[model samples]
Target chain A: MLVIVMTSIDPLTLVLAIGTPLYLAAAVLYSIRAVRGPTIPDIILAVDCLSYDLAVFLSAIALYYKTPFMTAPPIMLALWVYLLDIYASKYLITREVGV
Target chain B: MIEQVLFWTGSALFIIGGVFDLLGSIGLLRFPSFYVRLHAATIGAIYGAVLPLIGISLIALGSPGIPGNYTIAGASFVTALILLVVAPMGSHVLAHAAHKSKSVSWKPFVDMLEEDEEK
Candidate 1:
């Protein structure tokens, strides 16, 4: 009973079901700016922060959609490499123009 | 019943927050410069992601389960708490890094760090 039980539609599912697409759109907007950004660190930060949000968003999806498999990788991406990329990119930029 | 209500309310807030986050991301893409995009990214995470995480936790408390309830509730709670603490701090760090690196050239509004930079 415990393992196989599937809960009925919780209202929260509506949150992720709607939220993910909207957030992705917003992220795309931010990324567009990042793409055109005057400096390197700016793009890096946008990508980093968006990826972090995406991970959290994915976790909610996994819960509502009942798909843990879809959630785990994004979670890992946000928690792990996202920040590193920002840091590494910053270091590179600092070296590039001494900014 | 009360738990269910709270769960649903939290869910709405969470979803509302996520929508903001999405908008923030969209704003990031639409904005002309890095600094402006940063505003979108920060508000997106703060308004969008954090709120939803809290809502998810509230909903989890109402779910019936043996271990799944505990597992989901505990992990989600920790994740929410960590994000609440970390997200803003990360934003601050990123902003500082960008400023130091001069990654963003212009801003449409005044900055607190601008005063800090003068000192």
Candidate 2:
């Protein structure tokens, strides 16, 4: 699989070869912040950044594999992460998760 | 001609997004406070995520060889739009909650929100 992807001269393939590693490095950095954050908001912020980046990654992978099914997950992931932000904020303000 | 244009444009966007992603992540890690890191988060959310999603959609549309390319393009485009609407709102809400709750310690030169609330 690696050899096949590397051999392709497609523009998409070239972009993926360069872009994927950058995204991976970013993900690692975000994870570090998330793990060692001093406050709740810091953790949430790091997580929000990570999730959004992941959505992009997922879409790129879907394109690479030529799979339509994988495209749906990024949207769902983005929606769910937004819900997380809302819920976390609500909890912080009200001191309760429920409405 | 159009396909080549689309492909190259998407490739450029992808590279730009990747660079922004790395920069934002570095800022997120290096920034001293939670409030300061929000700027980095915004960069990561909008440029890092949205741009690449748009690029992916364009690549899908341009690449005829991909199976169900139209579906891939449509879904990625929709995802990018949704993230555009959702990310800032989420960040704002989180920042507001953090401020109100006094969860993070930071030194502000002029805290108008605190001053206003005290009055």
Best by DockQ: 2
Q: Is the docking of candidate 1 incorrect, acceptable, medium or high quality?
A: acceptable
Q: Please identify model 1 stretches exceeding 4 Å from their true place.
A: A2-4, A7-15, A65-78, A89-99, B65-67, B107-119
Tens-place lDDT per residue, model 1, A3-98, is: 454554445556566766766676666667667766766666676666667756666765665432443454455455346555654674476533
Model 1: lDDT of residue B98:
68
The CA-based lDDT of model 2 is what? 0.90
Candidate number of the best lDDT? 2
lDDT of candidate 1 over B20-107, digit per residue (tens): 7767766766677665666777777667666766666666666553235545555555666666666666666666676776656774
**Stretches > 4 Å off in candidate 2:** A1-9
Query: Which lDDT tens digits does candidate 2 get at residues A16-92?
Result: 99889999999999999999999988998898899999999999999888778888889999887878778888988
Instruction: Give Cα distance to truth, residue B43, candidate 1, Å.
Output: 0.8
